[model samples]
Target: MENMLVTRFGHAAVLVETEDARVLLDPGVFSVDEVFELERLDAIVVTHQHPDHLDRSRADALLARNRGALLLADPQTVEQLGAPWRAHRDGDRATFGSTTIAAVGELHAEIAPQLPRVSNVGVLVRSETGPTIFHPGDSYATVPADVDVLALPLSAPWAKVSETIAFAQQVAPAIAFPIHDRTISDAAYDIYWNHVANFGGVADLRRLGQTEATQV
Candidate 1:
């Protein structure tokens, strides 16, 4: 078993690479540029149909480039995007070469009471040798199990500082880092970090910026 490489493309998109597989998760608007640079992928997983998580044109472009890559997403998203893709619910699991991806959770956190809630699936990717990595999409849904590397969200319309910190502590991953933070200002980021660092007791919280990677 070889180590898996986790690379962030800012916002919700991430590239999880193992010796034999390369998986791209949520290649949305914020990550389209980074996604465009990739030459090949084994799979592309989308959490939902939100523009921020699934940019239609860019995703199509990616699939066009790599004809063999598979597209995996929740049922709602699959309905919206349509065909040639796998629909994963809360408990579905799929394997591609050396990597296994499990879909967790079903609904996106509420942006507001009046706004329609969309489907969102937090992805848990594991391999034989590397640390398990969980990207919880846009929801602070329960972590199905302990992970080695948790991609925690720092800021979003549906999240707050306290809730995000609590989520991290609850998941209790061996190492936690931030994602879904493209909307905040520099000052807001400082505030989020302050609270998260102070209240995220016992969890090894690492501040990972856009396009950053943490050794697994």
Candidate 2:
């Protein structure tokens, strides 16, 4: 994201600076200590209604602080936010500042009997670098199958190594990483390593994290 002047702010939150302005994604509430330090924002793109991924407090903070942020979200999320948000559906396309964004659909988890109502969406961020990064919300990791940088789930409820491998194999990104694993055990990381190293045609996994950004 060097050319796009992007930076990671922990969990799924990220800030992208195009030629015109900055855009925030997810902006998890925890990100307040780190990312919310920024004084201004051009817009916000929300993935779903999950608290960790879409904290109302954070948006409210942005509104109170920046006040100029334009919000984009899936329909259900749009309604839930209660703040005026431009709705974005799967396959819908739009641009934020100079950054081009595509909203895509994703499964919340490997099908569950009781939690079908929760909705999720993935984001394909197109930089002048062009489709360099993709965030698969808090999803099952099969969202964007062939982007430059694919961010998949490594440790969340129902997210096993098998599912991650399947997604890596399918997405086949040049470099891939995982998210939603804040409280997971070390075993999950081991699985992620083995799969990316051995799985044929899987993405060349890099495993970027929330720590001060470092290239793996």
lDDT of each: 0.82, 0.67
| Model 2: residues with Cα > 4 Å off, grouped in runs | 29-32, 141-146, 186-188, 200-204, 214-216
Model 2 vs truth, CA RMSD: 3.0
Model 2, range 93-177, lDDT digits (tens) per residue?
A: 7775556778888445554676675667788877664446777886654456457777666666666667677776777777666
Among the numbered candidates, top lDDT falls to: 1
Off by over 4 Å in 1: none
State residue 61's C-alpha deviation in candidate 1, in Å.
1.6
Model 1: which ten-residue window has the lowest total lDDT? 201-210
Model 1 error, position 191 (Å): 0.8
Candidate achieving the largest TM-score: 1
What TM-score goes with each of the models?
0.93, 0.82
Model 2, C-alpha of 174: deviation from truth (Å): 1.2
